[model samples]
Target: MKTFACALAALAIVASAPAAFAEDRSSARKAQDNGTRQIPVCRKNLGTVAIIEPDNQWWREFNLGSPEAILRVFVQQSRCFTLVNRGRSLQNSAMERALAEQGELQGGSNIGKGQIKAADYFLQPDIVSTNNNSGGGGIGGVLGGVGGLFGHGVGAIAGGLNIKKGEANVTLSIVNSRTTVEEALTEGYARKSDVSFGAGGGGFFGGTFGGVGGGGYQNTQIGQIIVLAYLDAYTKLVSQLGGLPENASAAAPPAK
Candidate 1:
């Protein structure tokens, strides 16, 4: 009887272990989700907003195109304001009537004239990134040298030991298009470090080979830092604007 009772107790513990672990994982995921999800302060929807392509020096330097499209993703996700296409052109009454006629044939409602909502605010994003080296030289050099003995490819892969740190700053502004006044401004900053390995080596036959390595560093990319800065800026922008009352009924000038 004693032996049977001990066996049952052990089985019960084993069965309960997985459940406890699953519960822990679930709790952790819930905590992470709560941390990441942004809750808008203003419950009511604000009026439409137009986003302008920023004159991005940082992106230009990196040969990346404008971040205006990326900014749109953040704005739309925030749900604080409706987004309108900046490229939308004004339509005349004749065009509206023609569209309405077409709609009637399709069994759809008539297209009303001047139904397009004008943007109440304009949002502009400015971003800048800089590199700041905090000391140099580490085990990365030794590992790089070892990889160079094998081949260029090996050295390049091992070069990931090399570290570089970068910082980025993003600024977002809200402007009242009608008043031409800046209503709110917010800034976000982020820092990240990247592991890079040196490329280029002599052929396996002759010549000299070189490789570079670095000390231990955080495994973060410069692009990730820039993106984080943008996300932070977006969060701040949303929080700032969400504090205002809904402006769905208000009219403002068109964005330029």
Candidate 2:
């Protein structure tokens, strides 16, 4: 019976070898491909850190930033100092997960505790967020068909029948460890369809939202440049305060 159990154990090890090898290979590929991922360096040296997750249900799908824009991920203490992580969140999450599954985060946490390190942050940017528009009207087909009613019901019906869609803006915020250290508000406008950033610049969409108090998220028009540019300005504010810690492996030319 002892000999049989030993044989079974050996068989199990052999059976698991290929699966383990494949997992390791998968992790290695991820580590390589995700190397260029990063977040912005926080401008203010705060003791606490905060992160804002993108809400796809409202905001359009954004690939971080455009090719021209740059992203940097780092750590910092609120109202204190900022530190660039040797590993950005995207890449580190990969490494961290692998460690966690293998019980390595336990050791990391030990070292991380009381380590004078700040919290983590992510920054996604799109440099060339522009829009342009050409004006025209599409009343030809309807106008021709309405030739008979154009003199009568057309005027009254058209006045109240033109349907308009409203736009919404989203702002994401976070409070860490019972204290509000950081907040990131990403205000973006949504259209019925995807729009060219350059073409839609300087345009506004107005409509009503259905909610109580006759007060819903209204007057929602955020310019592409103004929204993204606000990030740049905020980042600078954190940096000048010397809130982030230094990261030796930090990339100078963020991934294109």
Candidate 3:
């Protein structure tokens, strides 16, 4: 009995090894390192940027929160621009000012108007579209052909083996806040394939996006695809502004 128990424990550890290893190679880990994309660093600060999402609420379809969450991560990590709060956090700041105006706070609170930093540029993220299952070779049709030779039961079992591909098209744009001129517009795309339900796929969300807080981006398949797409777009945007080749990285020269 003792020997059997020890054997079971050893087997359990061995069985779990691959999963642990795979987790380490997961996309969440990659995202923390900014995935495969190299972030370009600017020697001179571009300007204060405010990240905003589209008004369409298209992300609601995928159960995602806001693109601002991840976009801000890229912006801050790139060290290109100062980020200003213009989203939900802005409302919080407004509430505080309202409180100060009501004299509901202590003296010298120093909460007042004109203290807000002006955004020199507006960085916006938009999801052009997403294809949850694309480029599939008609699983049903192949299975039907198989059924003619291998019988219905075998074909049905084989039907369970499906190859699914997901893709997303995302864009990032930067505009001069004062002049309201579009400075740069870049598009990014990412595609991923899943072997099937039993195979355990997707490099993203091995367990979670981990420390950086992925929000819904860590929880769903389409969300992960979108994250990669956006990362691609941001990469291009930075490279364009830095005058580097697309998807290339280098130290940006000081602003003239």
User: Which candidate number would show the highest TM-score if scored against the true structure?
Assistant: 3
Candidates in order, TM-scores: namely 0.52, 0.27, 0.63
Per-residue CA lDDT of model 3 for 1-256, tens digit only, reads 0000111111111112234565666554543332322334455566788987765556655567778877876777656788999978899999999999999989999999899988877998875545554345433433433345335554444444334646666778998776677879988876664212222322233322334474677556666667767767876676556432221112223335
Candidate 1 accuracy as lDDT:
0.48
lDDT of each: 0.48, 0.29, 0.59
Superposed Cα deviation of residue 95, candidate 1 (Å): 10
Question: What TM-score would you give candidate 1 relative to the actual structure?
Answer: 0.52
Q: Which lDDT tens digits does candidate 1 get at residues 99-170?
A: 776674355555666767778789887643333343343223323333333356444433442335455556
In model 1, the number of clashes is 4
lDDT of 2 at 44: 32
Q: Candidate 1 regions off by >4 Å? A: 1-42, 88-112, 132-163, 193-220, 248-256
Q: Which window of 10 residues has the lowest lDDT sum in candidate 1?
A: 204-213
* lDDT leader: 3
